[model samples]
Target: MKLKNILIVVNDIELAKKFYHDLFGLEVLLDSDGNVIMTEGLVLQDEKIWCEFVNKDIVHKNNSIELYFEEKDIEAFVEKLEKLYPKVEYVNHLMTYSWGQKVVRFYDLDGNLIEVRTPL
Candidate 1:
């Protein structure tokens, strides 16, 4: 068996699509009604549908998983993120590790954790 796309629940499908595209450059590969498949194998599902399927309350900031992305210019990415989404809650601002890898961690619009780091 092969691993498929990573699915995340979003309260607003259209807003989620635009958020992912604006921040991560992920375009919609397909829009299947309540489900949207985007580039890099990311899937956005409607929150109502997700809750019904899981039969549980949706929790935000669970911190169980994070979608990671690598960028050549992490500083520019962080600036863009701030300019575009000022209200974003950051787990950590851009910081460099001892090994010189810079990373920024923040939550997406729907509370999905995201970490953007400079290429190692």
Candidate 2:
């Protein structure tokens, strides 16, 4: 089977929608009352409904998983992010590894870890 999409449970659909679109330019491919599918195979679901379906309480602020993205122009992307979210918390500011890849890590509005890295 082919991998399709990654679904994330979000507290506020509208807030998450705005955050993803503004930050990553992920266009909405499909949208309903509780779910939204974005361009890059990302699906955002309402936490309440997700919890109901999973039969467990939704956890927040955990660092166990991260949504990763790669950018060709990582420097420009980082500059734009810094300007847009001046006060946003960062897991790590822009850094280059010995392997010659640059990466930045930060939390989304719902406290999900997100990393943007250069292609290796």
Candidate 3:
């Protein structure tokens, strides 16, 4: 089966929406109480509801996984990100890998790891 979407558990839906929209320019496809679906198959769900549904405690800052996005112009994207969010935590600041693709990593508002990279 083809992959569908990624659901992120968020502490606040409005805050997540603003962050994703302002930074990545994702448009809201659907918005309701405690849930929002944005462009590119990104879904934000309330953490309390998520935890209740999954029967597990909400965990933050788990750095084991990352949401990755490919950018056409990584440098330009980095410039915009830096200008808009100067205090964002960066795991790696604009580095080229051995494969020749440039990438930058950072944490989201809720400490989820996100990476943007240029195609090799």
Candidate 4:
């Protein structure tokens, strides 16, 4: 089997929805009283990632998940991300490594690291 949807615990549901929508342009697949679902491609064809915000004794912490967004213009994406999430930092300048690819990295909401890569 392949990996599927991932859940993120967020204290602010509205902010999370806005961030994800603005950053990645993910459309809302389902929205209820307390749950918010968003997806990119066909549910079974691609991954059905969902972000649910509940009012429980939940520990709002960052998981070991690194979300990556491939961008043709990494600089423009970075600019938009920075404006939305002020805590975003450039992990390093875009550089071609021995692996033969160029990449840049940054942090997203909840301090989860994200990488934007482009093949050279």
Candidate 5:
């Protein structure tokens, strides 16, 4: 068995696609109705479709899981994030670990937590 994709529920599929593309350069590989498959095996499913299939309420900012990305220039990434989405809620404003890794955590427009960290 292998992990093929990591799916996340989003309130707005278009906005989620744009968010991932604008920030991390992830392009859509396929768009199947309410489900969109993007580069890096990330899948975006519309909240309505997901809730119907799962028969449960959708939860945002549960803080149970987060999407992580690595960047050599995390500082520039953070700067762009601020410029593009001023209303974005941050989990932290750029912090460096004792091991010299810099990271910043924030919630996307849909309240999906994400962490951008320097490459190890």
Candidate 6:
């Protein structure tokens, strides 16, 4: 079976919304009740990722996921992110990992790790 949308649990929905919006330029396809739907083809499938925010602490703590973006202008992408959300600097800072991928790792407001990388 193919994987559909992935759920990212966060403590603060509004903050997470702003973070992802600034980082990926994602559109809010659906926003009703307490749920928000983000569409950007984050995964290969024709699926829309969902980020559900709850008042409780994250069910899965210290968890991270890496999303490899095929960016033609890496520098510009990084600059745009930095300008919008300075707090994400820790989550999106540039570094070379042992796997030889240049990545920027940082956490959402609720502590979910997010990495944007360019594999070498």
**In terms of lDDT, which candidate is strongest?**
5
Tens-digit lDDT track of model 3 for 1-120: 997789998998998898888878999999988888899999999998899899998778789889998998989988988887888898899999888989999998888899998976
- The predicted structure with the larger TM-score, 1 or 6, is 1
Ranking by lDDT: 5, 1, 2, 3, 4, 6
Candidate 3 pairs with clashing backbones: none
Better model by lDDT: candidate 1 vs candidate 3: 1
Estimate the overall C-alpha local distance difference test score of candidate 2: 0.90
For candidate 5, give the lDDT of residue 106. 95
Q: Report how far residue 46 has shifted in candidate 3, in Å.
A: 1.2
Cα error, candidate 6, residue 20 (Å): 1.3
Model 1 agreement with the true structure over 43-98: per-residue lDDT tens digits? 99999999999999999899999999999988889888999999999999999999
TM-score computed on alpha carbons, candidate 4: 0.64
Worst 10 residues of 1 by lDDT: 73-82
Report how far residue 51 has shifted in candidate 1, in Å. 0.9
Query: Using Cα atoms with residue i matched to residue i, what is each candidate's TM-score against the true structure?
Result: 0.97, 0.91, 0.90, 0.64, 0.97, 0.65
Model 4 residue pairs with clashes? none
Residues 40-90 of candidate 4 have per-residue lDDT tens digits of: 531211112222223334333344566666777766776777677767666
Question: lDDT of model 6 at residue 68?
Answer: 45
TM-score of candidate 5 to 2 decimals: 0.97
- Which whole-number lDDT from 0 to 100 does residue 63 have in model 6? 55
lDDT of each: 0.94, 0.90, 0.89, 0.60, 0.95, 0.58
Identify the runs in model 6 with alpha carbons over 4 angstroms from their true place.
41-61, 64-70, 89-92, 96-101
The RMSD of every model to the true structure, in order and in angstroms, is: 0.7, 1.3, 1.4, 6.0, 0.7, 5.9
Per-prediction tally of clashes: 0, 0, 0, 0, 0, 2
Alpha-carbon shift of residue 108 in model 6 (angstroms): 2.1
lDDT of 5 by residue, 1-120 (tens): 999999999999999999999999999999999999999999999999999999999888999999999999988998899998889999999999999999999999988899999998
- In candidate 3, position 118 carries an lDDT of 90
